[model samples]
Target: MALLNKYVGITTSDGQSHDGFIAHVDQDYITLAIPTNEMYGQMNGMPAREATYRQFGFFPGFFPRRRFFPRRIPFGAVTGLFLLPFFI
Candidate 1:
């Protein structure tokens, strides 16, 4: 699923909202790298800051960083599937 590598937003039947990139998908559920808003804060009022290599800490000469734990939404528990647009 090409969408697996792109950002996605999903709403569940329980009335909760989650936003992230699809990390894995199967007959059961979809894994999303939902940002840890509590840990990262809302990032509001920080317009000059954007998601980039440096945002998560990067080093061209030393290491390339990537380690994320995405949330899961069971296929049956999903109430909506939003595509191509972001509200987060």
Candidate 2:
């Protein structure tokens, strides 16, 4: 359970890679906190835009803000699991 709550990368049997925080783990599956970039306006089919705050010194460059949603992956389908460095 050392990987719990840690951001990590996962490769599945189908050869697809996924990145997320290890939210929960159990006997059969592992849940990942998948990051999504959905905001107030974006959900309404409007073009997503980042609001920059020069006074607050907040510049969302390459990595924009993210919200996490849980996704469950069965252990049987996992081909690889590794740790990754994540910063907000």
Candidate 3:
């Protein structure tokens, strides 16, 4: 639970990959704070907001939650866990 709200990468058995904050976690599932992608902006007809692509660090994944929310991945489906250094 220490990794809650911290950045992480999850790869599930279905070959899906995600990179975002650990929005929620439990024995049953893990939720990632998903950022809407470029198409989301164009689809919503919202003007592109200036991106703080480096808010936490130089890497794009560091502070990625923009127009964010949680996405749940069942723990049973998780094939790998890639935790960020600070969380350790």
Candidate 4:
């Protein structure tokens, strides 16, 4: 399974927590489609309020709650995969 598929929660710097599916991910950002209206604001394209990936927590498998693991695939690997078709 994809690494992004395992993440379940996003904890903001302010201590707010949001639960949702990850809609998009980039080197510095993650888009979370949270269920609650309060958390929905993060999806808005406001530059001052965007959430960072440091806020996210992933569940490795069938776990019911979120957990944190800091290590991630390097950015170069992701870029290579994304650009592979062009080189092919």
RMSD to the hidden true structure, all candidates = 10.1, 6.6, 8.9, 17.6
lDDT of 3 by residue, 1-88 (tens): 7778887888989899987888877889898987665333222322234353344343333333357767899999989888754343
Order of quality (TM-score): 2, 3, 1, 4
Candidate 2 lDDT, 27-73, residue by residue in tens: 99999999887743323322345463333343343333458878899
Best by lDDT: 2
Which window of ten consecutive residues has the lowest lDDT sum in model 1? 58-67
For each candidate, what is the lDDT?
Answer: 0.69, 0.79, 0.69, 0.39
Measured against the true structure, the TM-scores of the candidates, in listed sequence, are 0.57, 0.67, 0.58, 0.34
Residue 51 in model 3: lDDT:
54
Ranking by lDDT: 2, 3, 1, 4
For residues 1-88, could you state the per-residue lDDT of candidate 4 as single tens digits?
Answer: 2645443555554455544555567776655544332222222333332244223321222213223223333233322121111111
- The digit string of per-residue lDDT tens for model 1 on 28-74 reads 98999865523332343343444453555532222332345668789
TM-score preference between candidates 1 and 2, better one: 2
Higher TM-score: candidate 2 or 4?
2
lDDT of 1 at 8: 68
